[model samples]
Target: MKALVFGADGFEDLELFYPYHRLKEEGITTHVASMKKGPITGKHGYEITADIAFKDVNSADYDIIVISGGKGPEKMRLDKDALEIVKNFFKKNKPVASICHGPQVLVSADVIKGRKATCWIGIRDDIIAAGAQYEDSEVVVDGNLVSSRNPGDLHAFGREMIKLLK
Candidate 1:
Protein backbone atom coordinates (compact mmCIF):
# COMPACT_ATOMS: atom_id res chain seq x y z
CA MET A 1 0.00 0.00 0.00
CA LYS A 2 1.07 3.57 -0.64
CA ALA A 3 0.61 6.56 1.62
CA LEU A 4 1.09 10.26 1.03
CA VAL A 5 1.94 12.57 3.95
CA PHE A 6 1.50 16.32 3.60
CA GLY A 7 3.04 19.10 5.63
CA ALA A 8 5.18 22.22 5.46
CA ASP A 9 7.47 24.35 7.63
CA GLY A 10 6.81 24.39 11.38
CA PHE A 11 5.05 21.02 11.35
CA GLU A 12 4.88 19.20 14.66
CA ASP A 13 7.99 17.04 14.79
CA LEU A 14 6.37 13.92 16.23
CA GLU A 15 3.13 14.30 14.36
CA LEU A 16 4.89 13.97 10.99
CA PHE A 17 7.83 11.73 11.83
CA TYR A 18 5.92 9.17 13.89
CA PRO A 19 3.29 8.41 11.27
CA TYR A 20 5.69 8.51 8.33
CA HIS A 21 8.09 6.06 9.91
CA ARG A 22 5.41 3.93 11.55
CA LEU A 23 3.58 3.52 8.27
CA LYS A 24 6.83 2.57 6.60
CA GLU A 25 7.50 0.05 9.35
CA GLU A 26 4.14 -1.48 8.52
CA GLY A 27 5.50 -2.07 5.00
CA ILE A 28 3.49 0.68 3.49
CA THR A 29 5.29 2.84 0.92
CA THR A 30 5.09 6.41 2.17
CA HIS A 31 6.02 9.70 0.54
CA VAL A 32 6.09 13.21 1.92
CA ALA A 33 4.63 16.10 0.00
CA SER A 34 4.83 19.78 0.73
CA MET A 35 4.07 23.16 -0.84
CA LYS A 36 7.52 23.20 -2.41
CA LYS A 37 10.41 20.92 -3.17
CA GLY A 38 13.29 20.50 -0.74
CA PRO A 39 13.49 20.37 3.06
CA ILE A 40 10.61 21.25 5.33
CA THR A 41 11.48 22.17 8.92
CA GLY A 42 9.50 21.21 11.99
CA LYS A 43 8.60 23.43 14.89
CA HIS A 44 11.17 21.53 16.96
CA GLY A 45 14.09 22.23 14.57
CA TYR A 46 14.14 18.89 12.73
CA GLU A 47 13.96 18.98 8.96
CA ILE A 48 12.73 16.43 6.43
CA THR A 49 12.97 16.43 2.67
CA ALA A 50 9.68 16.37 0.85
CA ASP A 51 9.40 13.77 -1.89
CA ILE A 52 6.88 15.66 -3.95
CA ALA A 53 5.21 19.02 -4.31
CA PHE A 54 1.55 19.60 -3.61
CA LYS A 55 0.93 20.67 -7.22
CA ASP A 56 2.21 17.34 -8.43
CA VAL A 57 0.17 15.01 -6.26
CA ASN A 58 -2.52 12.71 -7.64
CA SER A 59 -4.62 11.42 -4.76
CA ALA A 60 -5.90 8.40 -6.72
CA ASP A 61 -2.40 6.99 -7.04
CA TYR A 62 -2.21 6.37 -3.31
CA ASP A 63 -4.22 4.37 -0.77
CA ILE A 64 -4.16 6.86 2.08
CA ILE A 65 -3.37 10.47 2.94
CA VAL A 66 -1.78 11.74 6.16
CA ILE A 67 -1.82 15.35 7.26
CA SER A 68 0.53 16.52 9.99
CA GLY A 69 -0.30 19.23 12.49
CA GLY A 70 1.63 22.35 13.55
CA LYS A 71 1.86 25.95 12.47
CA GLY A 72 2.49 24.44 9.06
CA PRO A 73 -1.19 23.70 8.50
CA GLU A 74 -1.98 27.33 9.18
CA LYS A 75 -0.21 28.21 5.93
CA MET A 76 -0.93 24.88 4.23
CA ARG A 77 -4.68 25.30 4.58
CA LEU A 78 -4.45 28.45 2.53
CA ASP A 79 -2.98 26.72 -0.45
CA LYS A 80 -5.62 25.85 -3.03
CA ASP A 81 -3.67 22.87 -4.29
CA ALA A 82 -3.14 21.57 -0.79
CA LEU A 83 -6.80 21.94 0.04
CA GLU A 84 -7.71 20.17 -3.22
CA ILE A 85 -5.47 17.22 -2.41
CA VAL A 86 -7.26 16.74 0.89
CA LYS A 87 -10.61 17.03 -0.87
CA ASN A 88 -9.69 14.50 -3.53
CA PHE A 89 -8.68 11.96 -0.93
CA PHE A 90 -11.98 12.45 0.88
CA LYS A 91 -13.86 12.43 -2.41
CA LYS A 92 -12.43 8.99 -3.13
CA ASN A 93 -13.23 7.75 0.38
CA LYS A 94 -9.65 6.70 0.97
CA PRO A 95 -8.39 6.50 4.52
CA VAL A 96 -7.19 9.87 5.82
CA ALA A 97 -5.21 10.37 9.02
CA SER A 98 -4.68 13.82 10.44
CA ILE A 99 -3.30 15.02 13.75
CA CYS A 100 -3.42 18.32 15.65
CA HIS A 101 -3.55 21.31 13.34
CA GLY A 102 -3.73 18.97 10.39
CA PRO A 103 -7.51 19.04 10.48
CA GLN A 104 -7.31 22.66 9.48
CA VAL A 105 -6.62 21.49 5.99
CA LEU A 106 -9.72 19.29 6.12
CA VAL A 107 -11.66 22.31 7.24
CA SER A 108 -10.42 24.26 4.23
CA ALA A 109 -11.19 21.33 1.97
CA ASP A 110 -14.71 21.46 3.36
CA VAL A 111 -14.85 17.67 3.75
CA ILE A 112 -15.35 17.18 7.49
CA LYS A 113 -18.61 19.00 7.92
CA GLY A 114 -20.51 16.09 9.44
CA ARG A 115 -17.63 13.84 10.42
CA LYS A 116 -16.57 13.25 13.99
CA ALA A 117 -12.97 14.44 14.48
CA THR A 118 -10.42 15.65 17.01
CA CYS A 119 -7.65 18.21 16.83
CA TRP A 120 -5.55 20.55 18.95
CA ILE A 121 -7.74 22.22 21.55
CA GLY A 122 -6.84 25.57 20.06
CA ILE A 123 -8.60 24.65 16.85
CA ARG A 124 -11.69 23.08 18.31
CA ASP A 125 -13.63 26.19 17.43
CA ASP A 126 -12.49 26.06 13.84
CA ILE A 127 -13.40 22.37 13.58
CA ILE A 128 -16.88 23.08 14.88
CA ALA A 129 -17.15 26.15 12.69
CA ALA A 130 -16.45 23.92 9.73
CA GLY A 131 -19.46 21.83 10.81
CA ALA A 132 -17.62 18.82 12.20
CA GLN A 133 -18.44 17.28 15.53
CA TYR A 134 -15.39 17.91 17.74
CA GLU A 135 -14.28 15.35 20.28
CA ASP A 136 -11.80 15.66 23.14
CA SER A 137 -10.52 12.11 22.90
CA GLU A 138 -6.97 11.12 22.04
CA VAL A 139 -8.14 9.72 18.74
CA VAL A 140 -11.30 9.54 16.69
CA VAL A 141 -12.06 7.36 13.69
CA ASP A 142 -15.07 8.40 11.71
CA GLY A 143 -15.54 6.32 8.60
CA ASN A 144 -12.39 6.70 6.46
CA LEU A 145 -11.02 9.60 8.47
CA VAL A 146 -8.84 9.25 11.54
CA SER A 147 -7.90 12.24 13.72
CA SER A 148 -6.02 12.97 16.90
CA ARG A 149 -5.64 15.86 19.32
CA ASN A 150 -1.91 16.50 19.62
CA PRO A 151 1.58 15.05 19.81
CA GLY A 152 0.64 13.38 23.10
CA ASP A 153 -1.91 11.40 21.13
CA LEU A 154 0.47 10.13 18.44
CA HIS A 155 0.44 6.57 19.75
CA ALA A 156 -3.33 6.25 19.49
CA PHE A 157 -3.22 8.23 16.24
CA GLY A 158 -0.73 5.91 14.61
CA ARG A 159 -2.45 2.83 15.95
CA GLU A 160 -5.83 3.91 14.65
CA MET A 161 -4.33 4.79 11.28
CA ILE A 162 -2.67 1.40 10.93
CA LYS A 163 -5.89 -0.27 11.99
CA LEU A 164 -7.78 1.64 9.34
CA LEU A 165 -5.22 0.72 6.72
CA LYS A 166 -5.57 -2.90 7.59
Candidate 2:
Protein backbone atom coordinates (compact mmCIF):
# COMPACT_ATOMS: atom_id res chain seq x y z
CA MET A 1 0.00 0.00 0.00
CA LYS A 2 1.04 3.60 -0.57
CA ALA A 3 0.41 6.55 1.75
CA LEU A 4 0.72 10.25 1.19
CA VAL A 5 1.63 12.50 4.12
CA PHE A 6 0.99 16.23 3.96
CA GLY A 7 3.17 18.49 6.03
CA ALA A 8 5.02 21.81 6.04
CA ASP A 9 7.26 23.88 8.25
CA GLY A 10 5.76 24.32 11.74
CA PHE A 11 4.06 20.93 11.79
CA GLU A 12 3.82 19.19 15.14
CA ASP A 13 6.79 16.83 15.31
CA LEU A 14 5.17 13.71 16.70
CA GLU A 15 1.94 14.15 14.80
CA LEU A 16 3.86 13.72 11.56
CA PHE A 17 6.59 11.31 12.43
CA TYR A 18 4.62 8.88 14.55
CA PRO A 19 2.05 7.82 11.99
CA TYR A 20 4.66 8.01 9.27
CA HIS A 21 6.99 5.50 10.91
CA ARG A 22 4.06 3.39 12.07
CA LEU A 23 2.86 3.06 8.49
CA LYS A 24 6.35 2.06 7.44
CA GLU A 25 6.46 -0.58 10.17
CA GLU A 26 3.31 -2.06 8.65
CA GLY A 27 5.09 -2.24 5.29
CA ILE A 28 3.26 0.68 3.71
CA THR A 29 5.28 2.81 1.33
CA THR A 30 4.82 6.39 2.48
CA HIS A 31 5.81 9.67 0.84
CA VAL A 32 5.74 13.13 2.33
CA ALA A 33 4.39 16.06 0.35
CA SER A 34 4.67 19.73 1.25
CA MET A 35 4.42 23.17 -0.28
CA LYS A 36 7.85 22.51 -1.76
CA LYS A 37 10.44 19.81 -1.86
CA GLY A 38 13.32 19.35 0.57
CA PRO A 39 13.49 19.89 4.34
CA ILE A 40 10.58 21.18 6.38
CA THR A 41 11.08 22.02 10.04
CA GLY A 42 8.66 21.12 12.77
CA LYS A 43 7.43 23.39 15.54
CA HIS A 44 9.80 21.67 17.97
CA GLY A 45 12.95 21.74 15.77
CA TYR A 46 12.61 18.30 14.16
CA GLU A 47 13.02 18.29 10.40
CA ILE A 48 11.73 16.00 7.60
CA THR A 49 12.35 16.16 3.92
CA ALA A 50 9.26 16.24 1.74
CA ASP A 51 9.40 13.81 -1.15
CA ILE A 52 7.11 15.83 -3.40
CA ALA A 53 5.41 19.19 -3.75
CA PHE A 54 1.68 19.65 -3.08
CA LYS A 55 1.04 20.63 -6.68
CA ASP A 56 2.67 17.47 -7.87
CA VAL A 57 0.70 15.01 -5.76
CA ASN A 58 -1.60 12.62 -7.60
CA SER A 59 -4.16 11.46 -5.12
CA ALA A 60 -4.96 8.40 -7.23
CA ASP A 61 -1.46 7.08 -6.70
CA TYR A 62 -1.91 6.56 -2.98
CA ASP A 63 -4.24 4.48 -0.83
CA ILE A 64 -4.38 6.93 2.07
CA ILE A 65 -3.56 10.52 3.00
CA VAL A 66 -2.32 11.68 6.38
CA ILE A 67 -2.41 15.35 7.39
CA SER A 68 -0.20 16.43 10.28
CA GLY A 69 -1.29 19.03 12.79
CA GLY A 70 0.25 22.24 14.18
CA LYS A 71 0.66 25.52 12.28
CA GLY A 72 1.37 23.77 9.02
CA PRO A 73 -2.30 23.15 8.28
CA GLU A 74 -2.90 26.88 8.66
CA LYS A 75 -0.83 27.34 5.52
CA MET A 76 -1.97 24.09 3.88
CA ARG A 77 -5.61 25.09 4.12
CA LEU A 78 -4.85 28.02 1.85
CA ASP A 79 -3.09 26.07 -0.84
CA LYS A 80 -5.41 25.27 -3.73
CA ASP A 81 -3.33 22.33 -4.80
CA ALA A 82 -3.34 20.87 -1.34
CA LEU A 83 -7.08 21.23 -0.92
CA GLU A 84 -7.68 19.66 -4.32
CA ILE A 85 -5.53 16.71 -3.40
CA VAL A 86 -7.55 16.26 -0.22
CA LYS A 87 -10.82 16.52 -2.13
CA ASN A 88 -9.72 13.81 -4.52
CA PHE A 89 -8.99 11.49 -1.64
CA PHE A 90 -12.45 12.03 -0.22
CA LYS A 91 -13.97 11.62 -3.64
CA LYS A 92 -12.39 8.19 -3.80
CA ASN A 93 -13.46 7.31 -0.27
CA LYS A 94 -9.86 6.53 0.64
CA PRO A 95 -8.64 6.49 4.22
CA VAL A 96 -7.79 9.95 5.56
CA ALA A 97 -6.07 10.48 8.89
CA SER A 98 -5.65 13.91 10.41
CA ILE A 99 -4.68 15.29 13.79
CA CYS A 100 -4.96 18.59 15.68
CA HIS A 101 -5.28 21.50 13.24
CA GLY A 102 -5.12 19.00 10.40
CA PRO A 103 -8.89 19.01 10.12
CA GLN A 104 -8.71 22.63 9.13
CA VAL A 105 -7.76 21.49 5.67
CA LEU A 106 -10.81 19.20 5.54
CA VAL A 107 -12.98 22.15 6.49
CA SER A 108 -11.44 24.20 3.70
CA ALA A 109 -12.04 21.37 1.29
CA ASP A 110 -15.70 21.41 2.41
CA VAL A 111 -15.54 17.69 3.13
CA ILE A 112 -15.99 17.58 6.90
CA LYS A 113 -19.67 18.41 6.95
CA GLY A 114 -21.85 16.02 8.94
CA ARG A 115 -18.87 13.86 9.84
CA LYS A 116 -18.05 12.91 13.39
CA ALA A 117 -14.52 14.20 13.98
CA THR A 118 -12.29 15.91 16.52
CA CYS A 119 -9.39 18.31 16.53
CA TRP A 120 -7.39 20.67 18.75
CA ILE A 121 -9.57 22.58 21.21
CA GLY A 122 -8.64 25.84 19.57
CA ILE A 123 -10.38 24.81 16.33
CA ARG A 124 -13.31 23.01 17.87
CA ASP A 125 -15.62 25.80 16.83
CA ASP A 126 -14.26 25.84 13.31
CA ILE A 127 -14.93 22.14 12.82
CA ILE A 128 -18.40 22.50 14.26
CA ALA A 129 -19.08 25.48 12.06
CA ALA A 130 -17.99 23.43 9.11
CA GLY A 131 -20.85 20.99 9.92
CA ALA A 132 -18.88 18.34 11.78
CA GLN A 133 -20.22 16.73 14.90
CA TYR A 134 -17.18 17.61 16.93
CA GLU A 135 -16.05 15.24 19.61
CA ASP A 136 -13.52 15.82 22.39
CA SER A 137 -12.28 12.26 22.41
CA GLU A 138 -8.71 11.17 21.79
CA VAL A 139 -9.78 9.89 18.38
CA VAL A 140 -12.90 9.98 16.21
CA VAL A 141 -13.45 7.76 13.22
CA ASP A 142 -16.14 8.65 10.70
CA GLY A 143 -16.36 6.47 7.64
CA ASN A 144 -13.08 6.93 5.82
CA LEU A 145 -11.85 9.75 8.03
CA VAL A 146 -9.95 9.35 11.27
CA SER A 147 -9.15 12.39 13.40
CA SER A 148 -7.47 13.09 16.69
CA ARG A 149 -7.21 15.98 19.12
CA ASN A 150 -3.47 16.59 19.68
CA PRO A 151 -0.05 15.04 20.00
CA GLY A 152 -1.13 13.32 23.21
CA ASP A 153 -3.65 11.40 21.11
CA LEU A 154 -1.17 10.19 18.51
CA HIS A 155 -1.27 6.63 19.76
CA ALA A 156 -5.02 6.36 19.36
CA PHE A 157 -4.83 8.27 16.13
CA GLY A 158 -2.22 5.98 14.60
CA ARG A 159 -3.96 2.90 15.88
CA GLU A 160 -7.29 3.86 14.39
CA MET A 161 -5.72 4.86 11.10
CA ILE A 162 -3.93 1.54 10.80
CA LYS A 163 -7.16 -0.25 11.51
CA LEU A 164 -8.76 1.51 8.58
CA LEU A 165 -5.79 0.66 6.39
CA LYS A 166 -6.24 -3.00 7.19
Candidate 3:
Protein backbone atom coordinates (compact mmCIF):
# COMPACT_ATOMS: atom_id res chain seq x y z
CA MET A 1 0.00 0.00 0.00
CA LYS A 2 1.07 3.56 -0.62
CA ALA A 3 0.77 6.05 2.21
CA LEU A 4 1.25 9.78 2.35
CA VAL A 5 2.54 11.19 5.65
CA PHE A 6 2.18 14.93 6.09
CA GLY A 7 4.23 17.08 8.43
CA ALA A 8 5.09 20.70 8.34
CA ASP A 9 8.14 22.11 10.13
CA GLY A 10 7.67 21.26 13.80
CA PHE A 11 6.01 17.90 14.07
CA GLU A 12 6.73 15.32 16.79
CA ASP A 13 9.88 13.47 15.84
CA LEU A 14 8.64 10.15 17.21
CA GLU A 15 5.29 10.54 15.51
CA LEU A 16 6.99 10.91 12.14
CA PHE A 17 9.81 8.39 12.42
CA TYR A 18 7.94 5.61 14.25
CA PRO A 19 5.11 5.42 11.74
CA TYR A 20 7.50 5.70 8.82
CA HIS A 21 9.59 2.82 10.11
CA ARG A 22 6.58 0.74 11.14
CA LEU A 23 4.97 1.14 7.74
CA LYS A 24 8.13 0.01 6.04
CA GLU A 25 8.10 -3.16 8.11
CA GLU A 26 4.70 -4.00 6.64
CA GLY A 27 6.06 -3.57 3.16
CA ILE A 28 4.10 -0.42 2.67
CA THR A 29 5.55 2.48 0.78
CA THR A 30 5.32 5.66 2.76
CA HIS A 31 6.33 9.07 1.50
CA VAL A 32 7.03 12.17 3.51
CA ALA A 33 5.19 15.04 1.87
CA SER A 34 5.96 18.24 3.65
CA MET A 35 5.79 21.98 3.03
CA LYS A 36 9.43 21.93 2.09
CA LYS A 37 11.88 19.42 0.65
CA GLY A 38 14.90 20.01 2.83
CA PRO A 39 15.30 19.29 6.55
CA ILE A 40 12.54 20.49 8.83
CA THR A 41 13.14 20.65 12.56
CA GLY A 42 10.93 18.67 14.93
CA LYS A 43 9.43 19.88 18.17
CA HIS A 44 12.36 18.37 20.10
CA GLY A 45 15.02 20.03 17.94
CA TYR A 46 15.55 17.03 15.69
CA GLU A 47 15.62 17.61 11.94
CA ILE A 48 14.25 15.43 9.17
CA THR A 49 14.47 15.98 5.46
CA ALA A 50 11.23 15.51 3.58
CA ASP A 51 11.06 13.02 0.76
CA ILE A 52 8.40 14.76 -1.33
CA ALA A 53 6.85 18.16 -1.59
CA PHE A 54 3.16 18.40 -0.64
CA LYS A 55 2.29 20.18 -3.90
CA ASP A 56 3.95 17.35 -5.76
CA VAL A 57 1.88 14.58 -4.16
CA ASN A 58 -1.50 13.67 -5.62
CA SER A 59 -4.22 12.14 -3.44
CA ALA A 60 -5.17 9.51 -5.99
CA ASP A 61 -1.76 7.94 -5.78
CA TYR A 62 -1.87 7.23 -2.08
CA ASP A 63 -3.84 4.57 -0.24
CA ILE A 64 -3.94 6.45 3.03
CA ILE A 65 -3.02 9.85 4.42
CA VAL A 66 -1.39 10.21 7.84
CA ILE A 67 -0.98 13.60 9.47
CA SER A 68 1.32 13.91 12.47
CA GLY A 69 1.18 16.77 14.92
CA GLY A 70 2.90 18.55 17.74
CA LYS A 71 3.83 22.22 18.26
CA GLY A 72 3.42 22.56 14.51
CA PRO A 73 -0.37 22.25 14.47
CA GLU A 74 -0.75 25.62 16.16
CA LYS A 75 0.58 27.09 12.93
CA MET A 76 -0.17 24.31 10.46
CA ARG A 77 -3.91 24.45 11.02
CA LEU A 78 -3.87 27.84 9.37
CA ASP A 79 -2.34 26.64 6.13
CA LYS A 80 -4.98 26.79 3.39
CA ASP A 81 -3.31 24.35 1.07
CA ALA A 82 -2.78 21.73 3.77
CA LEU A 83 -6.36 22.08 4.88
CA GLU A 84 -7.49 21.62 1.30
CA ILE A 85 -5.43 18.48 0.98
CA VAL A 86 -7.03 17.00 4.10
CA LYS A 87 -10.51 17.83 2.88
CA ASN A 88 -9.81 16.39 -0.54
CA PHE A 89 -8.55 13.11 0.88
CA PHE A 90 -11.44 12.81 3.32
CA LYS A 91 -13.95 13.60 0.62
CA LYS A 92 -12.45 10.85 -1.53
CA ASN A 93 -12.98 8.29 1.26
CA LYS A 94 -9.29 7.63 1.67
CA PRO A 95 -8.18 6.49 5.12
CA VAL A 96 -6.79 9.18 7.41
CA ALA A 97 -4.96 8.92 10.73
CA SER A 98 -4.03 11.89 12.86
CA ILE A 99 -2.07 12.15 16.08
CA CYS A 100 -1.39 14.75 18.78
CA HIS A 101 -2.58 18.09 17.40
CA GLY A 102 -2.90 16.78 13.88
CA PRO A 103 -6.68 16.74 14.12
CA GLN A 104 -6.54 20.49 13.80
CA VAL A 105 -5.97 20.12 10.11
CA LEU A 106 -9.05 17.94 9.81
CA VAL A 107 -10.94 20.51 11.80
CA SER A 108 -9.81 23.25 9.46
CA ALA A 109 -10.80 21.07 6.54
CA ASP A 110 -14.33 20.86 7.92
CA VAL A 111 -14.33 17.09 7.67
CA ILE A 112 -14.59 16.14 11.34
CA LYS A 113 -17.96 17.70 12.02
CA GLY A 114 -19.50 14.44 13.22
CA ARG A 115 -16.72 11.91 13.30
CA LYS A 116 -15.38 10.26 16.43
CA ALA A 117 -11.67 10.89 16.87
CA THR A 118 -8.88 11.12 19.42
CA CYS A 119 -6.18 13.72 19.87
CA TRP A 120 -4.11 15.31 22.59
CA ILE A 121 -6.32 16.59 25.41
CA GLY A 122 -5.54 20.24 24.85
CA ILE A 123 -6.96 20.06 21.33
CA ARG A 124 -10.10 18.07 22.07
CA ASP A 125 -12.21 21.19 22.13
CA ASP A 126 -10.95 22.17 18.73
CA ILE A 127 -11.76 18.73 17.38
CA ILE A 128 -15.26 18.86 18.83
CA ALA A 129 -15.88 22.27 17.35
CA ALA A 130 -14.77 21.00 13.99
CA GLY A 131 -17.75 18.59 14.11
CA ALA A 132 -16.20 15.47 15.57
CA GLN A 133 -17.05 13.44 18.64
CA TYR A 134 -13.85 13.48 20.62
CA GLU A 135 -12.73 10.37 22.49
CA ASP A 136 -10.23 10.11 25.33
CA SER A 137 -9.20 6.63 24.40
CA GLU A 138 -5.65 5.72 23.44
CA VAL A 139 -6.81 5.28 19.89
CA VAL A 140 -10.04 5.88 18.07
CA VAL A 141 -11.04 4.57 14.67
CA ASP A 142 -14.12 5.93 12.99
CA GLY A 143 -14.61 4.48 9.57
CA ASN A 144 -11.61 5.44 7.48
CA LEU A 145 -10.29 7.82 10.10
CA VAL A 146 -8.00 6.82 12.98
CA SER A 147 -6.39 8.86 15.75
CA SER A 148 -4.40 8.65 18.96
CA ARG A 149 -3.83 10.87 21.95
CA ASN A 150 -0.06 11.33 21.78
CA PRO A 151 3.30 9.80 21.07
CA GLY A 152 2.83 7.00 23.58
CA ASP A 153 -0.19 5.91 21.61
CA LEU A 154 1.97 5.27 18.58
CA HIS A 155 1.91 1.52 19.04
CA ALA A 156 -1.85 1.33 18.78
CA PHE A 157 -1.84 3.88 16.01
CA GLY A 158 0.69 1.93 14.03
CA ARG A 159 -1.15 -1.34 14.57
CA GLU A 160 -4.40 0.17 13.41
CA MET A 161 -2.76 1.73 10.37
CA ILE A 162 -1.17 -1.55 9.37
CA LYS A 163 -4.56 -3.18 9.48
CA LEU A 164 -6.07 -0.42 7.40
CA LEU A 165 -3.30 -0.67 4.84
CA LYS A 166 -3.66 -4.43 4.65
**Candidate 3 accuracy as lDDT:** 0.83
37-69: candidate 1 lDDT, tens digit per residue: 899999999999999998898878889899999
Across residues 51-106, which tens digit of lDDT does each residue of candidate 3 receive?
A: 88766767778888888888766666776766777888888877898999888888
Q: Ranking by lDDT, best first? A: 2, 1, 3
- Sorted on TM-score, best first, the list reads 2, 1, 3
Best by TM-score: 2
Taken over the whole model, the C-alpha lDDT of each candidate is 0.92, 0.95, 0.83
Between candidates 2 and 3, name the one with more favorable TM-score: 2
- lDDT string, candidate 2, 74-99, tens digits: 99998999999999989889999999
Off by more than 4 A, model 3: none
How far in Å is the alpha carbon of 97 misplaced in model 2?
Answer: 0.4
Q: Looking at model 1, which ten-residue stretch has the lowest summed lDDT?
A: 84-93
Model 1 CA deviation exceeding 4 Å by range: none
State in Å the error of residue 87, model 3: 1.5
The pairs that clash in candidate 2 are none
